[model samples]
Target: MPDTEGHPEVNEIELVDVFAALADPLRLKVVRDLLAEPDGVERHCTSFGLPVSKSTRSHHFKVLREAGLIRQVDRGNSRMATLRRADLETRFPGLLSSLS
Candidate 1:
């Protein structure tokens, strides 16, 4: 579903998957921090005092990304996460708005 600009169109992403991803307490905290962050000032992986080890933290982030709950991009040595607020709002209507 690439557009004329050669970018794959983001289709109608599922509500269940996104909600399920955020259902985890750790994942919910991750998304909440992302929502409050300013542009280019995303929360990093090391900042969260999650009880899990490094590998487990890696797994949660991966699930969040795959669920379309967050948009991730490499920033130097770490990956930055931004909550997909606008997209999720459109799909579920008032989902992030009410929660925020």
Candidate 2:
């Protein structure tokens, strides 16, 4: 399976990694907020208004992306993130729904 933006393939996504990533309250909030958005909607990172420093926010995003919980891409000067809802559902059914 091909990887996109360092995201794990659906088959490679592990429940442990996802749980670890979601363990962080800030990261979990990011996931929950993304879940609240309509499917396929992407939000700029800055839109979240995370209380952490810019680098800290970036770190949080990287963790989420690497955990296969989100798909992120660079857009101009900012990064945009979208929850990997379908992939999550395919890999672990009802996972995302339970988080919402």
Candidate 3:
């Protein structure tokens, strides 16, 4: 399958990586915000209101994507993000709920 924004393919998803990606305060908040959205909510990066530099924000998003916590796709002139909810839920049942 084609890679989606560098996220781990569904088969490659790992619990350890997901946990590590969520360990950071900022990243955890990012995930939380995404979770708060209605299912399939595609958000622009800046809409998160994260208190980080542009480069730092990009890095955080990269970490999350690499860890399979989120999937990003190009939308028009900007990139958008959405939580990888189903993949995460299947890999570790009820884990996302526990984070809230």
Candidate 4:
């Protein structure tokens, strides 16, 4: 099996965490934009164009990652962010769709 050490497994992701992560408007917008992407697409963190400062944007990404709402990877000189669609779908079917 793949490592689930540092990140949440599908079953470990809680609705509360998801809800909390989505509670912020900026974070919700990030998630919305991510979900709108083609499957497997990863956008650079800075490309999201969020109004927050670098530190705040970093914090948003961290919260989303910890809440199992997104997956972030360091690519070259920048971080890439992508929605954890598969895991989220498996854990909470129709949740993302309902949010749309």
Cα lDDT of all candidates, in order? 0.71, 0.91, 0.89, 0.86
- For 1-43, candidate 2 gives per-residue lDDT tens digits of 4375687888888899999999999999999999889999999
Q: List the residue pairs that clash in candidate 1.
A: none
1-100: candidate 3 lDDT, tens digit per residue? 4275587887788888888988899999999999998978999999999998999999999999998888999988898999989988888889889988
Q: Give, for candidate 1, the lowest lDDT window spanning 10 residues.
A: 1-10
**Can you give the TM-score per candidate against the true fold?**
0.78, 0.93, 0.93, 0.92
For candidate 3, the per-residue lDDT at 18 reads 85
lDDT of 1 by residue, 4-100 (tens): 3222224646778778888899988887777677644566776767889999998898878777776666789987667766677666787776556
In model 4, where do residues sit more than 4 Å from their true spots?
1-6
Q: Which candidate is the best by TM-score?
A: 2
Rank order by lDDT, top first?
2, 3, 4, 1
After superposition, the stretches of candidate 3 with alpha carbons farther than 4 Å from their true spots are 1-4
Model 3 worst lDDT run, 10 consecutive residues: 1-10
Query: Candidate 2: TM-score?
Result: 0.93
User: Model 4: per-residue lDDT, tens digit, 1-100?
Assistant: 2235235777889999899999999999999998888877999988889998999998999889888888888788888888989899999999999777
Task: List runs of model 2 lying over 4 Å from the truth.
Answer: 1-4
For model 2, how big is the CA root-mean-square deviation?
Answer: 1.4
RMSD in angstroms, all models?
Answer: 4.1, 1.4, 1.5, 2.3
Q: After superposition, how far is residue 52 of candidate 1 from its true place, in Å?
A: 1.2
